[model samples]
Target: MAWAGGQVNNPTQADAMKSRLQAIEQDLSKNWEKRDELNRTAERASTELKEIQERGIGLARSLYRYSAKADSLQTRLQQMQERERSKSAAMARRQGQLAATLSALQRMARMPAATLVAIPQPPQNTIRSAILLRATVPKLKDEATRLADELRTLKALRANIAGDSKSLAKTMADLEKERLSLSFLTAKKMRLLEKTRSAEHSAATRTARLSARAGNMRELLWALLKQKQSPELRGEDFEPPPAAGKPETATAEPPTPPRQTAALAPFRLPRGPIPALGRIVTAFGAKMPNGTLSKGVYISTRPSAPVVAPTKGRVMFAGVFRGYGNLVILELPNKDHVLISGMAKISAEIGDEVLAGEPLGEMAPSTSSLPKLYFELRRQGRPINPLPPKAARRNKVRG
Candidate 1:
């Protein structure tokens, strides 16, 4: 009998690779989510800071106006004080005149007694004279009462104006304090936003490094797989082929041909019309559950939304596929083929010419309530990541 333990293959290496891939993907997802959240928070902070700044500026202006009003009120109160002093001086002179008149009247009342004692002119001891004296006394008392009432009114007016001036000054000072506090808070807000931005940048850099490492890992694994598939490899072992163009005993070098260049200028997108309306649920080049490359961009769109080609190409296939449900593949004239799958309906027939940004067909609702369309562009059957290929990477190891 065959050795059962020997036939059981230990998947330690495969398990390790899968674990590493999962960790990398998890880290990438976490970082992306963090990046988005940080961006949103930063925006909110900036907006709040801006609003605070605007209000603070307005408050400053208002405080300045309040201060001006305080100054004006103070000036008015000072003027009123000066007028009060002048009125007091005038009232003092008037009171002196009234006092003299009263003194003269009292002397007159005593004159009759003095005249009777010194044998001078006889006192006018008639009823009409006494009545006239009493009437004069009443008039003098009324005049003094009117003067005192006027003095009280002027004093109250001055006190009221002073009180208002003091209150206004206090209010202005409070507003100034508030304005200062707002300024400080606005500065703090700006600092917080800056720190958030820096944190996001750091996270993005980490994500980029992780992405590059993952790419290298995938490339190495694919190369290893190709080696395993080669004819020189035995059923249980692997081997590498000989280097190309090097003879059995000699090697030679030659100059390469001139390289072709293409520029990718910015393209104008039509306003209000989206090229693809969907949520990007799955990322580009995400690892599959079975430890393989997803190898495309996944978009969750509606069934009625048309999938336009990012570039001009001819339809290569428009049918079902193994994993890409209701797929359509386009092969451009430059021998570049693009795959677009996960469609619920089809519009263009096979081998039909399609223009760049042209509507492909209506989509359908996916089982996940999120319709998805997977896309990828390839050259010579090998997947090629279609980035903004504006600049070509040329070999620069010196001619």
Candidate 2:
């Protein structure tokens, strides 16, 4: 519509607005066409990678929420663990006190006393009298120990669940960003289509160019979506050189402690019957369920089977571990720390000295059927692949 007198009509502004609207439509159309191509390409990628990509995307969406929940759960578990530990300490103190008191009382009883007051005995043939003093004392101690152990295990499982949850949560932010980008790309695609339909191109040449641009935009969008769905992509274009003054180098890790040569520690030997176990289900080099490789060997065994210490050392740590389940850390003189996981029982107490072949612990009977002895050889805190030699590699000749 033409403007009347005195109304300075700006047709150029109208044209510009029309042009922008046309561009938006064109971009959206292009995205729509290319998204299908991307999906096909993603389907062709390695199933493992595809799975990881899907997981990563899904994780990105839920990570933040999970992290908070995990952290809270972990806090609760930690509090419970502290309580359990306190309870255990108290129990141990009581056991020590009882042993000392009983020993003292027995020694006094043995010595002739100047004054003797006969305490009233139970009625003859009473069932309570049948309880043997020796059996009763040991049973009471065993019950206390079992209670402490159960609490420890529960704490460990809680921590592990929290750890897994935190890892899951960390991925949430990334997924959300991707989702938004996807939405933007989608909207852009729709706009492109709208542009293609509404553009008032008269000449055949102009129409062809607009169509080509629309096609390119579509391809770009499709490529982006594909990139998200598949981890593999051409890096040459995306790889940027280090910016000026920002040096980049490989990050270094902490060094492990050397082996100590002190005298060996001593502790109690296992009385339970030991049984043979089976092959390792997962190994140090074995690929984890995720893309990353594992850091230790998971020896499959019956749950009740004894977890023997491969070498003599002191029980440095004994507690529940996440992912690893019940764990015992043995500190060898060689500075090699052997971590035993998935135990039904931890016979060797934490800080207790123990000899080689000593039973560290055993798994539960139910667990024995699906038993896994996750062993890790670590130097200090750094993980060392246990599949290879604790001894130096030697060359061998072939026939």
Candidate 3:
């Protein structure tokens, strides 16, 4: 009886162990599925974000064009209105001259022949008066014709001014619609970015703390880079690139790396482009009013002009820094950094991975005197020119 019980108990222990192994296998399978589903979601989100950003940029460019058109139309309308006013004044003067000429002619026509002969004693004086009357009649007729032409011109000018005013109104309306659309797109983009950043709340909070404690731009950027290197701050989503030339393991597939990490990888050369669409008011290395050499080029943009990223990179610090106003610092590949300042509003947040031509922010509204944007590039903590070589050469020639 003891031998039989021992054998039965051993079989029961084996069955229990088998059941536990099956449960563990099921849990592992479920976790893998969940991870894959999350990856798909992330990919979809990224794709959607990219599409939104591209559309937003296109809309921004359209808005800029419309703004320029509206400004031109407004200027033309003002000039036309001024011309109309001047013509109207000239027409009034012509009417007065014509009225005086007509009154003189009427008085002469009403004068009796006997009265004229009685008033004039000398026949030669009478003949001269008659000659003068003849000449005045023709002159009055010519003046009346000239006045009629001036009135016609004034009417045409007024019509043109009215037409231009209508055009300006239409252009302004179009501009407002485009602006509203862009605002909507911007809000949508923010929502998507926030969703992706939800998991990195702790990292973002730490970055904010670091930014607050930072003394200057350099210190803040240094702290951010250091923090990004830490494993804890990188979060669980961070995936280091696989070892170079390592053999692939068949047991399981490696996780896909995060987009930000891929963007942070070193590149051959950093791209140098103006981050905004505008004219360069202050060139790099130019003498400033304070008698100091300017480190970055200042671009004078239209009111509420769209500002874009100069290149693909990750945002390290984005907020008001020092006296630079709303500023954004992007960490580029190959240890390069780009700083943009003078934005009235910053659309990007810290740790955002931005693509080239992506909307960064916007310049101040037309309320400001002149909206100027500053672009500065740095490599390994030293300031460098942000303009491309060709552009720099062209600027030099212009200078």
- The estimated TM-scores of all candidates read 0.38, 0.29, 0.71
Local distance difference test, candidate 1 = 0.52
Which should have the higher lDDT, number 2 or number 3? 3
User: Over the stretch 195-247, how does candidate 3's per-residue lDDT look in tens digits?
Assistant: 77775667767776776666656566666777877736532232333233533
| Stretches > 4 Å off in candidate 2 | 1-276, 388-399
lDDT of each: 0.52, 0.47, 0.71
Off by over 4 Å in 3: 1-9, 120-133, 136-143, 198-303, 310-313, 331-338, 366-372, 375-399
Q: Which segments of model 1 are wrong by more than 4 Å?
A: 1-11, 113-153, 169-177, 180-187, 190-399
- What TM value does model 1 have? 0.38
Task: Name the Cα RMSD for model 3.
Answer: 11.2
Candidate 2 has its poorest 10 consecutive residues by lDDT at: 390-399
**What are the per-residue Cα lDDT tens digits for candidate 2 across 213-323?**
322222322332233344344322232222335322111221321222122221112111111133456645556777655666665553344455555676645555445
Top model by lDDT, which number? 3
What's the distance in Å from true for residue 280, model 1? 62
Cα distance off (Å), candidate 2, residue 301: 0.6
RMSD of each: 30.8, 24.2, 11.2
